[model samples]
Target: MVEGRPVGRVGDVDWLLTGSGDPVTVFAHGFGGGISDTRPLGSGVDGTRVFLSFRGHGGSGPLPPDWTYDTLADDVRQVADLHGATRAVGASLGAGALTRLVADEPERFERLVLFLPAVLDEPRPAEARGRFVALADALDADDEDRLASVVALEVPAEFSGSAAARTYVRQRTVALRAPGMREALRRLPALTAVPSADALRALRAPTSVIGCVGDPLHPASVAEALADAVPNAILHVYPQPGVLWNQRGDLRRRISEFLNSR
Candidate 1:
């Protein structure tokens, strides 16, 4: 559907394209994020931006029963091939997939930026899994208040006290109302566990990591572990999620500088 390359089904997943230039960059969104979540990072970049909505996210199709990090990474690889993207950035679960992709096919990407990776060292707790299940239940029932309540529990203590943060959580949670969103949330924990830290040490691409404070689900330690494991990796830790909107400029500068340096 776009000018440069064929835009349609890649295996079973669908991708939306944006921007136009050389040396394409792909922006992969977090667990709850869709194409819109990628807009801020992709907008000012000086190249084509491919925003991939993973299976069951945004406009993409439902996830297969066997879906895992490898499946998601392969989907990203398909998009990278379609657009010839050598530089890419991803957040949370999206970042986990990108890490897996680079580990599997290092030649596919020249550089990468990982933000708030959800991949953790320990197995996901039953409490957290229960929270996601409850979120899906609330979403299935279309109970906005219940959905917000479940999400609020995960918000960092600092952000929970602020009105803007609550509003932002509500706004972000609305995306779960989309068709197939429940499947994505329910499967997220398993996906996060794959492409383990030991597996990521093999990645060769230069990478930069961004960590946010006060988010229990995406702790700063995960980012630190990744930066230490991957070759040629750097990290920047932000204060909290509430400042992310105003901090886009800093994020953009760092990602661009890192990608351009190589």
Candidate 2:
């Protein structure tokens, strides 16, 4: 069973530390997601799992009065120190957080795995942000139809081709139908800043980035850019699209190899 404990309390932010084993692997979920999202990957890995649900995501509590990725990195550091994690895996937004964490404290993590990281170093399109806000509002209002429409718009096109992918989407959508999601989405503007390429290149930790072919939001170019920026960082392109987290076996193998090497 996955064990859990409260690590740090930053205002309303209460970071949770969980799992077992030496050289623990800390996991940070994507935007709007929580510790639960990392369960699958954590289960697949060998070491103890340390999962942190950022403020406004999952059971961690509401957003801080003022929030930024740097602050989130501090939260990650506190959680890692509390749980004694020597490796870290971050998915999507979490990946971006890990980048900042490893950049600031290279000795903390032995290995890092980033899945569909959001590191554009540029502003995302205004229309995309507007659509996300609208969806969040619709979710808050309990407008199911509007929520479904927003999901259709935001979900990558490849999700339509696979039954498993559709099922996963259905499950996630149901989970997101809950109340606090609107507030989580409202924090997107603050979470959207991209890390500098130079900073990424200077990272000393052994790192790997996984990209999906069909994910519109995190295209292959983004992963390639990250790989190029990070010294000796390996880039893996999965046949599937988007950040489903369950489509490929190569991800597990790569992470295992990277961690074992350290």
Candidate 3:
């Protein structure tokens, strides 16, 4: 069991390497999230973990004006290729990135975990997009109070106003400090993860699609659809969106068992 290490940059991506053995797992945090957001989720899982922050998210470089899904996927692709990751885990924005990458390069990873998937082929709902826009607006205004409030709204009622939720919100707010992230947030709303579900059928890796009941942003339907499309995907739908907040131990165990089993 290796402790965490300092973050290093490869091109535009900020990557943190932890553990040190076979079955390397690359973790891509959600949009407006950093490595701290996802690192603890897989803490109980063994093997080397390469945690990466997409551009303008986790100490990574600022986003290019025209950045899109391809840029995000390429960020994950870059870290995975460089680290020789045997498995990968993605949450929301990161899950979208993995979907695009694996669709084109099916054999890139041996195992996969798509947790809290936000979208697939179709564009997300306007309400979801609106939420992102609101977040960006708050961030752009540099309103810490508003940003924290907006972030807190994303937390499920199961963990609403809890100490853990506060910390989680802080992480998201702190991550938004990355340069030029407001544009990244505004641009992402209109983009679908991949071209089509037909593209995902090409995926060769066994996948674990995890979702929850009430998250409008990362809807459970998307996770179900992803699991249905992937030839060999296991579905895990937690009762609440705050699975990471209240059910963390269970979530970590599931992630550990799945990644270790491969």
Candidate 4:
């Protein structure tokens, strides 16, 4: 079962630490997502894995009144330091937090994984901000159906009618109905993860950047740009957006291989 007891706060942020051994792998989930959402990729990996949710995210504390990607990186740093982790993994918004963390401290981590990164050095277009804003509005209104509708826009069209998609959207909608969720979605989409490409160029860790074609929310171009900008980064482009469903084994094996590389 995927569960964790509240073992108190780390760096004023709540998180769950699991596994054992050296080379601990810390996980940061996307916005409005719980650690369970990231466990699929981190499972069976070498060494220990610790998952940290941002101040307002996952099951963490209430969202701070004033915080950005850089501020959130402090939370990541605290968790990694406490565990003596040499590797870290992030998805979407978490990817943003990690990028900010590494940009400021290039050698903070020995290895890094950015899965389905949503943004890089710049803020996405105005149109791209609509979904998140819509979500925030829906959440403020306490409209579950509206929240589901906004999530549906993020899922691939081909899978929209499937049972898995319904369950996925439902789970997301429920998880997002938290105290500070609306405020987060409202402020985040407008913020940039890092100031410029120079932020990526300073990275000194061996990194893996993974993305897929069909996910408009997390574009492949952003992933490609991150790979190009980082000095020692490798890129992986999955053929479809539903990589967790279609490329599960391949991805699991790839993460293991990359994390275990000599």
lDDT for predicted candidate 3 compared with the true structure: 0.86
Counting only residues 3 or more apart in sequence or on different chains, how many pairs clash (N, Cα, C under 3 Å) in candidate 2?
A: 1
Model 4 per-residue lDDT tens digits across residues 104-202: 999989999988888887787566687778888898888878888888886777778899989889888877887777777878777878888687787
- Tens-digit lDDT track of model 2 for 74-178: 767877777688889888778877877776675677788888876546544455467667878877788876776676665566556467556655666775764
- Rank by TM-score, highest first: 3, 4, 1, 2
- Where does candidate 4 have its weakest 10-residue lDDT segment? 1-10
Candidate 3 lDDT, 5-98, residue by residue in tens: 8778889898999889898999998887778778887798788999998888756788789987889899998998898897999999999999
- Model with the higher TM-score, candidate 1 or 2: 1
TM-score of each: 0.84, 0.81, 0.93, 0.92
Using alpha carbons, what is the TM-score of model 4? 0.92
Q: lDDT winner among the candidates? A: 3
Scored by TM-score, the top model is 3
Q: lDDT values of the candidates?
A: 0.75, 0.69, 0.86, 0.82
- Taking all chains together, the TM-score of candidate 2 against the true structure is 0.81
Between candidates 1 and 4, the one scoring higher on lDDT is: 4
